[model samples]
Target: MEVVSEDIPVVIAFTPNYFVPVATCISSVLRNADEDARFHFICLLTEALPEHMQQLLNELVGELGRFTFMDLTGTLSADIYVDPKYTIAASYRLLLPDLLPQYDKVLYIDCDMIFRNDLSELYHRVDLDDNYMAGVFEATLEQQLAHMQVIGCAPGTYINSGLLLMNLKKLREDGMVAKFLEAATQEGLEFPDQDVINQLCKGRIIGLPPFWNSIRTFLLPQYKADFLRFYTEQDWQTVQRKGNVHYTGPKPWKTFTVAFDLWWRYYFKLPKPMQALLIIPTKLSLLAKIYQTFLGKTILDGTRALYRKLKRNEG
Candidate 1:
């Protein structure tokens, strides 16, 4: 397929362990995209893919859209501290402007999400003339303020980095990469890459609608009050319509959640072999938990109850 200038450029980063999640993410996007829509995917890798995984990825890329594998080794300096919890690949998004100068715009999406509708609307809808990038605001003002303090950005300027519509030309013109690198090296942030992006592009980051990046935090009971306080009923309705559900914590493949079923629906759509390889672990894990619960209730607890009942009858 000839990649036209109008084709949207998407970038996703992952380590070797994340191949399955990234595959599911790409599959979900293609499934929902318009028939003629084109996407040029840039896969930033912390390590090279295994041969089998590479073959699977190649097949998927060949069938759906164009892709390029970017090796991230030796590219970023060690002074940039990536938290042990997150892979170094998370920081690769900062390199996009310098890496893809041919494109005026690019979209960065986390691998831990699934698209519910065509992304062409999001790509074409958000205006990026004056903004460095467009992203959904953090869930609460307090969280946003905390991030703002870490990055020295103004309140409400902080955004979740899971989904971003980047203005690559403008960022490149401003030498944002150098600035981001300086800030990242100087400061140890709670969310390193995201904070650096917010700090460097503070006033220039526009807040898009929440539906574009529906974070899992909003659905948790602890955050429900904050969710309601920040968003209106209409906003919630919009999320239901076309929101890209981001599995920010406890991925569906590892554990079951309200969204796990949705993730599996897309997983099942994959070729049978791929499905078997990926789904078995999740299914077995769930079954193991169920079996443990059954044993505790029927074997251990049941014997204890029986002993208690006999003692009461003797009394």
Candidate 2:
């Protein structure tokens, strides 16, 4: 099934810790890609190499067949430190704006994603008219705009940060990246990196259907349509058509089992005994979380996810 690079139109993703699960998800998508447009998938790691991780990374690279690696701190223009408070996942916010220049149109996926089909279709779907950037309509563009205003960006622009197909050429030409960095600084009211892109590219960015980034497609509770105007049906019609499933929420790693059971299948040539050990804990954690997710048959929502903190506070 593997062919030489195939000179595919590029797709990029970034991950810290060199996650094997995410790498598997990414590879699965690439494997199914059209030969005409093979994938140029690139990923980044945010930390110094640990011996175990180093070996794992090597194994990942070997199994990947074709992919690129970029060390986080090594590639940045300047050292970015968001309040040393929470081990900030902020470097990605800083790095993305700068990294946008390196390619034409890049698909930047979060580490917690899986690929259901060849990304070539989505890559082709990006239509940059009206300054719109493609992503789901969840918390619709209107709500996204409200969030943007809070962060000092023009309203009506906000995209889900999880999986972004960025048009780097357009971004550079419009001076959006510089603007994003300025808006994203520590002193300048902290907004997530995804919000910045949504704000800056509002109105002009196109909206992809909800299926491409189906945050709650399978995981969340389902509901029926209005049956009158056909509006809800329209959304479902759009949803029925898609090629990828993005598992973007409290992942199975913290819980007893990941939502999509599909993520459990990724692997390398590592010894079976070693894999057995790794998967066992991963599965156990997922199982334990399923109970934790439930508060008497109702999945915990919002602040309840911070049960540990609640205990500390109570203590």
The C-alpha stretches of model 1 lying farther than 4 A from their native spots are 1-3, 61-63, 141-147, 279-315
Clashes found in each candidate (C-alpha, N, C closer than 3 A)? 0, 18
Q: What range of 10 consecutive residues in model 2 has the weakest lDDT sum?
A: 222-231
Superposed Cα RMSD, model 1: 7.7
Winning model by TM-score: 1
C-alpha lDDT values of all predictions: 0.77, 0.50
lDDT of 1 by residue, 1-315 (tens): 245675778899998777778888889999888877878888898887677877787777675567778887989998987877788899999888898878888889999999987787789877899789999986565655665665686544568999999999999998989888877776457888988887778778888878888888654434555666667767776775667889988887786553555676677567665665554575645543443454633664455557757876897
Off by over 4 Å in 2: 1-18, 48-65, 74-102, 129-132, 140-157, 186-191, 217-219, 222-231, 237-243, 265-279, 282-315
Output the lDDT of residue 268, model 2.
35
Q: Which candidate leads in lDDT?
A: 1
Residues 166-223 of candidate 2 have per-residue lDDT tens digits of 6667666677766766655534334445555655566666666555665543233222
